[model samples]
Target: MIRRINDIVAKHIQGNLITYFFVILFFMTGISSGAFMSKALTDFQNKELIVYLKNFFSIVDSKAINNLAILKQSLLNNFQTGIIIWILGVTVIGIPLILLIIGLRGFIIGFTVGFFVKQMGFKGVIFSLVSILPQNILIVPCTVFIGVLGISFSLMLIKNKTRKNTRYSIVNQFFLYSTIIAMIHIIIVVGCLIEAYISPFFIKYISTYM
Candidate 1:
């Protein structure tokens, strides 16, 4: 079963390498830009920001362990994002909007990772691994995949159709695409569990030592 799943995933990724590459590039640009900005900040500004971040971290550390609430919040947020992406994919003018959202998500993630890594160096990387990477490990790839697929489907409407294609064919493809999104939705929920239940504990443990 595991091998089969791997093979299926491999096939999907292999078939969309270009799309994946561009999506990855878009995300990496955000990361790089964020890191550069972090690095370029004045020393005084950096110090002030670090102080704020540490205080924020303390607040998070002191929060009660409420996995259920966390999970619900995570799921709701991800679900909303997924639905918006899907809805945008169905519209003619949605291509740019989809890209903007993807870029924004990437920017936020990049800024977060950059902020920590710059503040604590290697320790920050460890902190990010524990606190940030768990959910994003699932989310980032799935998000890119969905974005690529959504763009591909949306473009079908604008493409000059050959004789073999019909509206019904596109409709079928949309349904198939939706089914894939549903599977991704389930994965997001699992990611939410990890983000809620596991990441916090590890992050707290890391913080105590840091």
Candidate 2:
């Protein structure tokens, strides 16, 4: 099973190497920018953030996290993002926007980890591992996948612009695109469940040490 999956992935990557490269590069660039932004925080801002982190820890230690609220927010955010990317895939002008969205997602994650490590050092790393990494393991890949799909679809539309009798082909491609997006969202739903139900426990456990 693992071998088959690997073969499939290898084939996909081989076929879409340029798209994957651009998508991954853009995401990495965003991460680098976010980390730099974290470093550029003023002393006052750093202090304020430290205080906020402390309060967050306190909440986790007290087990005060509202799980349902978290789940609802996660689902809403994930689904909204998924829908946006899916829609963008159907429009030629949305390629840049899709890439930008992917980059922004990376930036948020990079800024968060960069801040944690900068302030708390090793303890901060542990805190980030428990609180942030779990859900993002799923989310990061899904975001990139959707971004690639969006860009690819937009490019397809542009490529077929001069061709005749392509309406049926476009419709077929769109259906396939939507189907794949639906599958990606199912994975996202699982990621959200992990974020809300499982990560909180890890956060609560680690908060005591921090």
Candidate 3:
């Protein structure tokens, strides 16, 4: 069973290399642009985030003060959505659709972080890391999984491998990929919760001393 899972993972990685490259490239470009932009808007963005945080802290109940669980669950929900998009992309017209879906996801991350870093200066970069890194660590794997599954299906189409139980192959692939995606979602949520409640206080203290 381990070997079988490994084989599937290896195949998925090899197949999706091209798509991964494009996605990474686009994401990096966005990050670079966002960093520059963040520098331009540092004061504004910092002020806004600070104000927002203060407001959020004010009315939030003591129970809600510990929002780690909610943040974690939100990350998991996001990953599950990615999994759904991947499954949909496997259908007859789903290949390009998957690419579009992944691309958009990457774009949003790039844009937000880029704008953030650009606006905050070095502190902005630090803030971005504190804010997005935890969730992103979870998201990257999910995105890669989607890319691999999409590529695998595309390969099947190109090679005309639709014979001798093609339906079974499709079903198996979907099941396997979905399971992995779900697992990733769970892991990410757990990480997010920790980061949300715990990291902020530590980060804020550290920033003050620095």
Which structure among the candidates has the greatest TM-score?
2
Order of candidate numbers by lDDT, starting with the best:
2, 1, 3
Q: What are the per-residue Cα lDDT tens digits for candidate 2 across 1-210?
A: 999988987887798899999999989989988988999999999999999989888877876789899999999998998899899989989988988988888788889999999998998899889889999899889989888888899999999999999999999999999998899898998899999999998888888888
Best by lDDT: 2
**Order of candidate numbers by TM-score, starting with the best:** 2, 1, 3
Q: After superposition, how far is residue 1 of candidate 2 from its true place, in Å?
A: 7.8
Between prediction 1 and prediction 2, which has the larger lDDT?
A: 2
Alpha-carbon runs more than 4 Å astray in model 1: 1-8, 41-48, 61-63, 160-165
The lDDT per prediction is 0.81, 0.90, 0.61
Model 2 segments beyond 4 Å from truth? 1-8
Q: Of models 2 and 3, which has the larger lDDT?
A: 2
| Local accuracy of candidate 1 as per-residue lDDT tens digits, 127-197 | 88898899999987778878877776677756735446478877888899889988988888888999999
Per-residue CA lDDT of model 3 for 133-203, tens digit only, reads 76567666656565556556655655555477577766776677667666665665665665677655545
* TM-score winner, 2 or 3: 2
